[model samples]
Target: MKNILIVGGSKGIGNAILLQQLEQNKVYNISRNAPEVTHDNLVHFSLNVLEDALPEIESIDTIIYCPGSINLKPINSLSIDDFRNDFEINVIGAVKVIQKYLATLKKGTNPSIVLFSTVAAKLGMPFHASIATAKAGVEGLVKSLGAELASAVRINAIAPTITDTTLAAGILRNDRMKENMVERHPMKGYLQATEVAGMADFLISDKAKSISGQVFEMDYGIVSFKI
Candidate 1:
């Protein structure tokens, strides 16, 4: 079984990926809080990716960085620190985890890395300036590192539209809000963590061995179509 390290795997899409991978692979989860479930193949690390030092693991075949921010606000209401905090969470944290585990990852079987982005980075949406800018940086990193790590390791990013998670609780707080969100997407629905997790599973598996440095949009047609 492959040894997978998932940063911020305690909640939302990260937690969903953690649960699914445990059925087949050994999963190492690092997040501020512990996961709700446990299994023989699961390992949990409690710490902040930005404020705390990451734990060491000897073998890691796949690394999935899932920490992100949803700091939505009008440009006039946004502060410089808003941009800085979002960038640090969405981009710098991923960089830290990758750099820390680069050596061990290089020695593993079919080593690969996955990072999370957002459709806001591609679809021009109001009140998304901070997060969009940050996730955009993540896309750039995926492209550059996909080339730099070519032949040694593979890297990619997933850009999902508004997902049904606590991170988006503010937007989908009520039935009317939820209905509006569904109507906004051409698919007439938003994303579930499981669907995004499935994509993450594919991107890290041998099935996608030939893919790297790409951003797959799980936007449910929000970014892909006008209708």
Candidate 2:
């Protein structure tokens, strides 16, 4: 079984990935809060990726950085700190985790890394300036690191459209809003955490051994089609 380290695996898409991997791999979760479920193959580390020092693990085959922000607001209403905070959460934190575990990862079997972006980075949505800028940085990191770590390791990112998670609770808070969101997508639906989790699972597996430095958009056609 692979040894996987998932930063911010306490909730939402992260938690879904954590649960899915528990049956097959040993998972190390680092987040501010503990995950609600307990499993023999699971271990928890309580710390902030940006504020606290990450714990040491002897070996790790995959690193999945799941911390992100969705601070949507008009440019006039957004502050510099808003951009800073979002960048730190969406990009810097992933950098910190990857740097900390690079050595151990290099030594592991079929080592790979996965980071998250958002469709907002490419879709040009209103009120998404801060997050779009930040997730754009994430995409850059994936491309650069995919080349830098070419032989030693592999890296990629997932860019999902508005997922039904607490992070997006503000947007999908009402039935009317939810319907609007569904209608916005050509697929007529938004994403479930499980579907994103499945993509994460594929990126880190031997099945994706040939893939790296790419951003997979789970956008439900929002970014891919006009219909």
Model 2 alpha-carbon miss at residue 110, Å: 0.6
lDDT of 2 by residue, 1-227 (tens): 99999998999999999999999999999999999999999999998889998898998999999999888789999999999999999989999999899999999999999999999889999999999999999999999999999999999999999899998999999999999999999999999999999999999988999999999999989999986
Against the true structure, candidate 1 has what lDDT? 0.95
Q: Against the correct fold, how does model 2 do in TM-score?
A: 0.99
RMSD (Å) of each candidate, 1 decimal: 0.7, 0.6
Q: 1-227 in candidate 1: lDDT tens per residue?
A: 99999998999999999999998999999999999998999999999999998998999999999999888889999999999999999899999999999999999999999999999999999999999999999999999999999999999999999999888899889999999999999999999999999999999999999999899999879999985
What TM-score would every model get versus the actual structure? 0.98, 0.99
